[model samples]
Target chain A: MKMAEKRPLDDTELDGLFAAARSTGPEPSGDLLARIMGDADAKTAAVTRVSRPEAGRDVVRARPGLLATLLGLIGGWPAAAGLMTATVAGLAIGLATPDTLDDLTGGVLTSVTGYELEDFMPSYGDLLEEG
Target chain B: MALDALTDVSDEALLIAFGNGDAGAARALTLRLTPRVLGFASRMLGGDRAEAEDVAQEAMLRLWKVAGEWRQGEAKVTTWLYRVVSNLCTDRLRKARGVGIDQIPEPEDDAASAETGLQDKARAAALQGALDELPERQRQAVILRHIEGMANPDIAVVMDIGVEAVESLTARGKRALAAKLAGRRVELGYEDG
Candidate 1:
């Protein structure tokens, strides 16, 4: 009767069996992981490999080159100021010029007649009106 | 946020962490993962532990390579790992011209041989030999369910098969295992008194 005792398979038994089996496989350690990850990191190095100056890496650039400084200035406030000044100066000159309404209309007449601007200025519209 | 919150996080989310150089997440994914992958490979390769290790390791290396493209919230990481390992195993088996373990080569040696004086080792070896004789899917299914203690749905996910398929494999595998173990029932503690 003792030999015939029934023992049902339980979750714990199954886990025990499996855990025992799991012990058969190799265990990957931290160093193994580091090797794999390091190999991956090497791939990143292949893409962009540059070496900056180690001596002054933390310091501000000692002396910006003349061309580099010029380019920087051109790309910075000086260029913006130059552009605004040019625009404002051009507008002021246009406003102060003694050129009349006829002078402004001359180019339009020249395009319409295929005539040169010098040849068909103030006299041209007057001649046309009379004719 | 805690790791439990990350249970909701998709495989792709874990992969995205890996891509962003999150070494902790990478380590977690590896430790929590490689065993399952190794288990699958080992089953398919018919207990050729070395080849299985290679397959699992290469599969993981490929995962790292594709980390850049892994989209978070897209697919389960384990599924992708399974498919990769499966393909690798298939490729290796195909090239080797022998489906090593499934073809029971004349019942080789004393499966319970004790070159070492360990009864547990002998039993484990005998169990492994029996497992080696099982058909590919049966072995895989059984190893996943009975041996690895994986849930049916997760096994389905890892095997890239439906739940019904998983159920069928497990049932058939268990039946085959029972048949195979009938002779060694005393050893497996399943003897009829």
Candidate 2:
């Protein structure tokens, strides 16, 4: 089909046409904005979480408990050695005097309850004196 | 206070801030960019409001995804966004079957005097009808150059064409629009020559 003659719009007319079109330009709806912002928030949250290990590490200082603090104060292998030493010493003492542990247990129970122990019970002070 | 701070930041800076988890920056960028995208998409999609909205949102979504990796100095942010909107509108237009312009509702404007506003709407509708009849590239070039008032170089970037090509398309587009609208001048409230 033969095309019609192209009659160019005058600049003034073009301006009027454009002005009318510009005035009629669509505004982004509130629903659309909310949806886009929601997507942004989600993606931002994802990026933040992924990067948290590096940036957030300093902000998140983990507090150790009391036992952990004490253990840390003594430091690494020395704490373990100290615990082993105490355990060995107690075992040696118990083997040397088998009744010592039993006597101490009974004497502590009798003192606390004010219940007299039988003749077999020995006080901590008496054992010390004997040793 | 922070929102205030972000208000003056450049669009690139705002996107970077948004990538770093600033809600204020996202709001600022959204306010700055969405309307332009919506307007461009609407014009490109032949006044299809719903499709234009979808295109705008999708384009913005792509922008957010790439914000952290958006290389500054590579491209202008607005240029990049316009390009995205252009591509998205193209994709939808290719896939869409038949469209009804009558389905498009008139804009709500409570601020203007009723008669003037109605006339304005009629003129706008007439222009859009003329625009829809143009080829896609011509329509885009004309809208960007005329209605959006973008510079030729910027229009070239958005349309992915040479600046000379941009000028040619716009000139032809204007001529066609004028030919189409010549009969409606009186109805559009234009005085007779």
Candidate 3:
């Protein structure tokens, strides 16, 4: 007796096989996942180091310089500016007393110190005459 | 953010987060992508789990390296990954051409409780054997289309070919597979038509 001829898998049969393959697909082992995550972490760290200068020696450079540190201690630029203005005004008042300031103080500073402004800071002419 | 929280996140977002050194994203991406990558590599490498694992690792390593440069909204993450795996597999296959096909290991068997599970496993194994006999491009096209359930346009992107070409390749590949699997119908639990 002759045997029946074999036939190719139909589309439905092939699709069934594909479905089986999909269902039985290989999973990544824990070791493989660890290795991959390790790579990701390493890569991410490397990229972070490159993109963030604060992570490296640049961090030291990024620190406040001497002037900046002083300014920060004095409460930033606005406070420094105010302090500077007060220092300049005080020096101006001491070097060349404004009549208005003297009036405002009621000459109490000179009276209490027992010295006129010229007594503390003599004119250039006084030095020239002494020479 | 928690890994579970990232379940709804897109692959590109996770990749960008990973690029930014988010450990959570890294874990989420690993859990999500590694299985798919391994499965595709295993099929591409003819069920050599070891080689497939190596390929998947290398491919993912490359993905991590390129994560910083991965432009958003330009390409699909899985598509880009598939392309990378395809190239890596092709390189390995070319280098291993000197090795005989018989040296390739068979697919691993899974424990199945029901007879139907056994039948499915057999069918899958027989299909894998047939696929291994196909030309590399044909095998790739068929696997991407059928097993991976990718659209032709996406397969074209992964393969770097036109849609028409992808269609042609898949058609031809299906024909080749049908011919190759013709004799195994009964053995694979299929009734002769």
Candidate 4:
């Protein structure tokens, strides 16, 4: 003879099982918690290290010296060299009294005043007389 | 901030704080999430406590790594963690295929001497045994919906399926469970309705 068939559990009974499962859910062990927390600590430390500014590395450099500042203001070494060349050339031309420059001026001062360029400059005696 | 002080703070906020290097937030998040992760992993792995613990630890480690990039209000922290644990358990389950449902371990008895308590434990164990027989997706959907008490939409997010699909999976899963457990009803203290 065939045995009687069993019926499937109803929703209420199944829910009871689910509720039991929920109530009996496992609690994490202290060792598991420690391992997870250790990972968190290590990860946090790594992130902190990445975000932290390193000492002595990110500091603004010392301010430029006065002469260096002046040099920079004049447009760096190339411009400074150009200015120096122009100044020295002017000084040499004035000291040497280049005839070419006198010709360029067409000797106009000498002709107009009937005196050389040196004559316009005060001598020691002239200076003493003026004093 | 103190751990106690962080009790009222949201999980997303705690994660952001941890991202910003708050050790308190790390502790808070770890304490808050590990149990849930472990429970889900335990059920997914057929109550393999050791493997569940490993999965829980790895999942939390991934969470810590991602805390720095956790986008607040985009997803709930628990949902994201469930997804991670799901994937990890799936990988392990795939690797350990052919392990019969009989191999599934019974959950530890919590020293419940009372008859009701023992009945509850037996019911829970019986349910776990039936859950072990379902397809992986069905198992996940059922656990997330019934045991974990998650909403269908959130279950969809965790299972990476649409809400309607979650409903179908859970329906089929519960039917399968009911059929599987029908034979054990008398043994598990269930009365016919």
lDDT of candidate 4 vs native? 0.88
Instruction: Provide the TM-score for each candidate, comma-separated.
Output: 0.57, 0.70, 0.76, 0.74
Which parts of model 4 are misplaced by more than 4 Å? A53-131
Worst 10 residues of 1 chain B by lDDT: B104-113
- Fnat, one value per model: 0.09, 0.71, 0.90, 0.93
Q: DockQ of candidate 3?
A: 0.54
DockQ of each: 0.09, 0.37, 0.54, 0.54
User: Which regions of candidate 1 are displaced past 4 Å?
Assistant: A1-16, A29-35, A46-131, B1-14, B99-120, B189-192
RMSD of each: 11.2, 15.9, 9.4, 13.1
Weakest 10 consecutive residues of candidate 4 chain B by summed lDDT = B101-110
Give one digit per residue, the lDDT tens place, for model 1 in A17-101: 4554665544554554565556556544432243235335645746777866876877966787788899998787667754564
Estimate every model's Cα lDDT from 0 to 1: 0.65, 0.82, 0.89, 0.88
Error of 4 at B80 (Å): 0.6
Under CAPRI classification, how is model 3 graded? Answer: medium
Q: Any idea what lDDT model 1 has? A: 0.65
lDDT of 2 by residue, A10-119 (tens): 77886887898888677787999999999899898898778879667755676777877878878866887988899999888766755666597875633455555755
Alpha-carbon runs more than 4 Å astray in model 2: A1-9, A53-131, B1-5, B97-113
Clashing pairs in 1: none
